[model samples]
Target: MFTPVTIETCITFHGHVCGGISLGYVLANYAMDKLGAQRGDDLYARMECQNCLVDGVQCVTGCTTGKRNLEIIPGGPMALTLVRRDTGKGVRAVISVDMPHGLSKEEAKNHILSLDPAAICTFEEATLELPN
Candidate 1:
């Protein structure tokens, strides 16, 4: 059986979750599929965004810096890359589109703060390599 990662789970890991982290969870799964891999016993999550989104990836993927399964590079385009620890196969995840709710900036903040998954993020996938 397969169960999807939920926003509640992200909240527990983040201690303060947001749509970005929730999206990270989804994107991580998507990236795994694109890379012909699964979370399995070992994997690497390469991240670009330094925002709250990283929290979700850390929790859902079980690939945190503490475990040496994650490597983050700050000050770049907001993106994430996952590598298989054994095979070296990898995929990069990037947000291609950010859905808008026609609300003011403040409203957007309120919505995110309210734990809304209303913000839809479309992704464009690419095959990539994590440095060996």
Candidate 2:
């Protein structure tokens, strides 16, 4: 379970709390739950954007850039796919929530946290993609 304390740790590691991280946190936890993933497991994450979301996933799942298990591919919509390298099973999450433009960062974060992760994003089964 990625609890509020985990979000606090992610915020400290990320330098601030924002909507992106909160969404990422929710999505990451949802995906992890779907895949039965635990922190420090042989997990691989493919992120579809370059932003705060990456930090949330990294902190929550213990998959890091240095570990070469987190890949950030820019130019796509905000999405994340997490796979267990051992079984090639994974889940893809694409954000579906829409926040108004005028909300403050805290408001945005809280708005994201208040909803169910499935309400904030859509999830589907996926297979790991790796280049030879």
Candidate 3:
């Protein structure tokens, strides 16, 4: 059965650049779509996820126009969540990809090593809410 889902993600960048927000939004949307497709589901028919990036300066100036570069964590595992909505039959799933800033190979390795694997596992497990 076809169901309706809405997913919204907001990312904030702290720098002077253009299109970072929009780029992030695009990347996020693409990631979500890909995730859904891989799971044998149609994203267009069952889900709606919107991505938004906001710059610090433009947010303050209220200009509503800015471009910026986005640094996404590459080669990391993507997170997916499926939540049941109030309609009782509808489902919403969110796919999140963490794009870290550009780092040297060594630095990136070290950063990953520094994280607590157990915590990461817990967070990943908590993202999903299936229908009853």
Please tell me which predicted candidate would have the highest lDDT against the true structure: 2
Off by over 4 Å in 2: 1-5
Judging by TM-score against the true structure, name the best candidate: 2
| Candidate 3 TM-score versus the reference | 0.21
TM-scores, all candidates, are 0.69, 0.90, 0.21
Residue 13 lDDT, candidate 3, scale 0-100: 39
lDDT of 1 at 66: 89
Tens-digit lDDT string for candidate 1 (1-132): 234456577777777644566556666655665666644546788788777678877766777888777888887665778777676666677755462368664454455445422233334444345545
Worst 10 residues of 1 by lDDT: 115-124
Deviation in Å, model 1, residue 1 alpha carbon: 12
In candidate 3, which residue ranges exceed 4 Å CA deviation?
1-77, 80-97, 123-132
| lDDT tens per residue, model 3, 1-132 | 423221121222333322334333333333334333222231111212222332221222121222211122233333222222222222222323343368653454345334443322222112223213
Compose the digit string of candidate 2's lDDT tens values, residues 7-68.
77878888987887887788788888888888867789999988888888888877789988
Q: After superposition, how far is residue 104 of candidate 1 from its true place, in Å?
A: 10
